[model samples]
Target: MFKQKYGTTALVAGASEGMGAAYAHALASRGMNLVLIARRKEELEATAADIATRYGVKVLPVVCDLAAPDATQQIIHVIGDTAIDFLVYNAALSFIGPYLSTGPSTHLDIAAVNVQTPLALLHYFGGKMVARRRGGIVMMASLAGFQGSGFLATYGASKAFDRVLAEGLWYEWKPFGVDVIACCAGATATPNYNNTHPRKGSFLEPKAQLPAQVVEECLQKIGTVPSFVSGTGNKLVSFLLSHVLPRKKTVKIMGDSMHKIYGSKWESN
Candidate 1:
């Protein structure tokens, strides 16, 4: 059922490694051909080759920076007339320190990668999906988006946009046979996450999930809900933050956790 509905070809942005690569592999395993996009050429091509070999499905690797102004056009140009049945927008930029420490350009770039590009791509591909009357979209959101995270302020705000966008689109597009979902993942063992060097024994480290686990859970829940926090622990935490706790308390909890993880690297503006 999954393959038949969304199996023709899937496009995974930021598919060079980590969760994006995992999404690509999962879709390929389900018999979907793929068009993988990322900034790193070698890594992207290597991932595409490996998936094609392992799953015996067509894989096209397109190297393009999602932060670029013309990212959506670049992807569309590369894919040509090939129809994309599913889209996984996984590209994101984050700054994990005092928000004011970074220059305005850095925050703008984060907004571009995390919010603007995804919105543009959704408008492009989502329209096609609605027209075809069959498709799916998975926008990678984050648990931090639930509140005003201290260090990840801008990134969280951008993800909040994605989460709401997906929810609204899910409602508007479902009638047209298109399934849109936002996978609000918690801490996962992705390269980008690991690069942050989260403090060991911190509250988030113990709860960190594997990329494959995150991707699998996301795939399972895509057509069932507009959005979901991936993982059992994450669900519990999300529930507490959103329902049980007050908004002020929720923001403080996230702020404290982020401070614990990246406080050492914090710089004064």
Candidate 2:
């Protein structure tokens, strides 16, 4: 049923490893050919080869930096006429510190990766889907997007943009037979998240989810809702942060969590 609806081929950005790789494997398990994009050549090709061997589906690995201005064009060139029935934008760039700590260049790169590329891809592939009258899109948003996160301010803002964009597109494209969803994921045990080396025994540490679990929930809920928080705990937390608490309190709570995890001077990409 999953494959029949959004099968044949899928394109996943930032698919070299972690949650992106999980998304690739899940789609391939459903018998979909894959076009995997990421910046790491060795990792991307290795992931593609492994998926092809394990699932017996065509896997094309394209090593392209999502922050590059011509990233969407590069992907389109590699994909040629392959109609991507499902598109997943999972690539992101984050600087985990005070916003002003990073220079303008770093913030610009984050905007490029987290915002520009996804919007460009959506416009290109989504237009094709609308014409064909069938397809799906998954934009990887974050729980941080629900409000102003202290340390991860820029990244959270970009994700908020994605969440709202996906919801609006969901409504606009529903009648055209295209499904758009923003997977508002919580803290998952991805390589990047682990690299941050978050301190033990924090309020949210124990609640951290695995990559496979997050991707599984995302796939299951894509066509069902315009946007959804991946984990049950995340869902509850999202509600409390967005609906139950006052804005200042919610922001303070998130800020304190970040302080606990990364302290004042740490950074991670």
Candidate 3:
């Protein structure tokens, strides 16, 4: 059965809504006090209030743009001396389009939010966890991380970095009683997913999971494994990609699926 294996205080980045919020709910239900971080103060406060009231656990909401240059510093300052037993690095930004056509600023923003912020948190908080000999880290990754995605080049690469980093950290920290996990999710029901791929049965659409399902699965596996794909369908698909398909075939299939979803929007050059 599931258990609360980490410390009392848990911090969740991108906790304003979607999967991040779901993670907060799961943790709070497991009796962990929350430190919620997100760009939207109102949304963050609302989520914090609801969770605090429902689970009877204290919730602190910190507003910060994770892509900002000093976001990690600001977050650390707000956290003060509280020991974060579990850290969920869930914030991410992706400018979905052909890589070359996207502006450099947007690309940098993606890198900052998806890569730099997580790295900073893991380095700082993870070090503390290692010293104390107990804690857990969950990095939100995606199926795109496993292969070269055509339209989502930057996003895919960034997720790949997250997945690899989480795995390496997991290996390193486990011996010291720290648990690190990469939650590689497939298409889930989110505002971003709905807006981007409006049609059904397109690539990841067929097996779309709920945010709650992903969070529950992630929580169950966090302390036990280095990584987990959120949904059953996603796990099966990941296994096939890993064991059955060659890299060329896998990349082609993923690229073709992406083209079907995004090709209509691109202007002919």
Candidate 4:
């Protein structure tokens, strides 16, 4: 198995819920123990208990707010001497509004979690993986990364950085037996998604997929490829946006969609 080539422990950041928890479940099912990290201590504990019960694998829940300044060090401290064979950078922050109108602090917080944390974690764990000559890294990116969207400018940009970083790491790490992949998924049916976009059906947009399905696709594609967009509908849309349409038009269309979703809050402070 792909996972067997790596060690027995996997660290999944943001594993209290959504796609993060899904990855935790998938990893446990593969007979790997888990170290789950997130800010929500209660949710993290609950998820840890459930996964441990179901899979009979050790599950440790580390509650560290990724937005906190010392998050990377806190996570490493919580991990202690556990050998993390797989690292999944899944925690993220989504701030939807006009970029200029948003506070600088908000942007910094988003950058800390979405961009800085991943790079720091990779630098710490990736070194170990290379030294051991076996490991994997899965970074959660998004379709928004492909284009510049009005309301989602910062989030999109952060994810784009993630995608490119993972692609580059895949090249550099492949020779060292470390698998790296950027799993870019679109409109997943996470609790956050259901809460945000309640009325689902849309002629222009594909239905949001289940978290399990998206995470499964990510795990399956990890060792085989550098990057993959999860859904079929997402793939087509991404292809058209990048290849067929003008970049300006793509951005405008995405902005219009976000406006529809966020309504009065689209560009308003």
Winner on TM-score (2 vs 4): 2
TM-score of each: 0.96, 0.96, 0.94, 0.96
- Candidate 1, which segments miss by more than 4 Å at Cα? 200-206, 267-269
Clashes of each: 0, 0, 0, 0
Deviation in angstroms for 200 in model 2? 4.7
Clash pairs, model 1 backbone: none
* Better candidate number, 2 or 3, judged by TM-score: 2
Q: Which residue pairs clash within candidate 2?
A: none
Query: Tens digits of per-residue lDDT for model 3 on 69-162?
Result: 8998999898899889899998989876678887899989999999998888889999999999999899999999999988888899999999
Q: List where candidate 2 sits over 4 angstroms from the true fold.
A: 200-206, 264-269
Q: Model 4: runs farther than 4 Å from truth?
A: 198-202, 265-269
lDDT string for model 4 (59-103, tens) is 999999999878989988877888899999999998887787779
Candidate 4 clash pair list? none
Q: TM-score for candidate 1, please give it.
A: 0.96
- The window of 10 residues in a row where model 1 has the poorest summed lDDT is 198-207
